[model samples]
Target: MVGRKPERKSAPPTDVRAHVLASATRLFAARGFDGTSLQAIADEVGVAKPSVLHHFPSKEALRASVLDNMLAHWSEALPRLLLAATAGEGRFDALVGELISFFAADTDRAKLLVREAMDRPDEVRLLLTAQVRPWQTAISEYIRKGQRHDEHFADVDAEAYVLHVINLVIAGLAVFDTFRVLLPDASVAESRARYVTEIIRIAKSSLFAGPALSAEPRDPSLEGAPNRRNGTTR
Candidate 1:
């Protein structure tokens, strides 16, 4: 007797939805939200327009879903890394490294965020209030806590420092495409590493207004086993 052929399994619904969201993120990042359409997202995902609609009813809905996912990841990841660090220097270095990796993973997020800040101020305002503000506030609080505990961090202005750090990270990654072209010899990975190194240097040298920090940079990998700190998983 002949055996039956193995049946091929279809992707799960969640997987399908995730693929669509990933396609939408790429499109929205490159084309801007208004420039990217539902049909385009469907085409990019190789799914029918109705299928895309089933996952995300409208362009705005899709954009919201994408932003929500990005915000959720950053909000959780940043806090976890910060809390995991045993000291202020460690926390600061981890923060810089993570920010570099986050934006470097996709330039679109950086571009989309900067564009939305200018083009759709109200949407940005809502995003900040709902997601970003809380994480940022926590980081600021951590900086302030360091200032209180360590003389070396005495003159650090938590608010200004955080804002400037964000601006530097986002701005660098946003324009990195051009930088890659300009320095064609450098692979994207090489460029990112170099940029992160420079960012770490700046943070260590300029951000603190106190005595000179140790000349050595902290470990870039920020390796640690899974652990808990301040009630957060780290």
Candidate 2:
């Protein structure tokens, strides 16, 4: 009896489910939908394949569950974030900050969305309608409010601005690897801070009716820059 070891207790169902979802999220982000399997998810979660299926009936179902859970989280949080933005001095900046922080909190989430959209458009659409589109619609309304009330937003098209902001936040995080390389001198924290500042600055300039924030003249060394998108010189 003295030499016997105490038995280890198994995690409850909720904990196991969360673990499975987390492991699946990481796997799906790193490996495309076709690249990952239920067995691999089971192995990562230290559960039997059947156990995983018990919580999620099939592979598609599991992926949906993961995305649904993430979306549910955002759905709950959005109201509070919007409220904060409304109460803040710089409402637009505050909203952008909240968004940047949200995606930055879970770097894998954006990557997962990007990968899934590219690989499994059908599945992505399901999630987009259920979760993403609602948020976009709400934010679009908020942008419209700013356009009506805020001096900076008065000239901007609410729809186009909403799309630009969403793309900037998601695409920036989705392609952060390239950002890291391009910003070799900055730490991740610095890069994120700088990026957020720049985004907010650009948004304000584009929307807000004000003089340019910087007073310095343009550098004469590069007077004529080529516009890559249209192949024109500026």
Candidate 3:
């Protein structure tokens, strides 16, 4: 008994489920859903295939859970984030900052979304309409309010602008690591800061009527919100 090595304990069920979801997300992002198998996910999570199925009944269910996990975080957090700031430029900064932070906190999220969009446009469209369209409409209405108040640029298409900014943030972050190679002189942190800063700047400048709002920095607190994954607070 003295010479025996201790047995490795298995992860708790909740932790195993979370790990399986997380691993499935990364795998589905790297390889399309059709390409990734339940066995691969199990291997990634260091568990047996039955362990993965214990939580998710099938690969389709796992993929759905993974997508839902990402969207669920946004669904819960977006309203709070929007409410935290006053209207106009405050809301603008809050929205942009949170958007950037959400994806930057885990680029795999961006990759997963992008991959899904590319691989399954119709499915993603339907999912977005159901889950994301309300928020998009709310933000667009806010933009319209700013326009009516003469705070935002006249003639800006509110829906189009919101859609474009969403795409910019997701697409930009999806390829951020690879794109950083173009900025050879800067450290990864510096490059990332510059990258996000420019995005905020561009978003502000294009939307705001005057230069004052465009020059203000985004809410520092929004930038610092803890990274969330698999519907759990971190």
Best by lDDT: 3
Candidates' TM-scores? 0.72, 0.74, 0.78
- What is the per-residue lDDT of model 2 for residues 81-143, given as tens digits with 9 covering 90 to 100? 778667635565567767777788887777877887888889778866876677677767766
- TM-score (C-alpha) between model 1 and the true structure: 0.72
**What's the lDDT for candidate 3?**
0.77
Residue 119 displacement (Å), model 1: 2.5
Give the per-residue lDDT of model 1 (tens digit) for 132-210: 5776788788777766767336777777777788888887777777776764544777656566566666765665545
| lDDT (Cα, tens digit) per residue for candidate 3, span 31-107 | 77889989788776777778788899888888889999988887776776667555543556676778888898888
Question: Quick one: ranking by lDDT, best first?
Answer: 3, 2, 1
Error of 2 at 24 (Å): 0.1
TM-score winner between candidates 2 and 3? 3
* lDDT of every predicted structure (CA atoms): 0.69, 0.69, 0.77
Best by TM-score: 3
Weakest lDDT window of 10 consecutive positions for candidate 1 = 225-234
* Model 2 pairs whose backbones collide: 152-207, 152-208
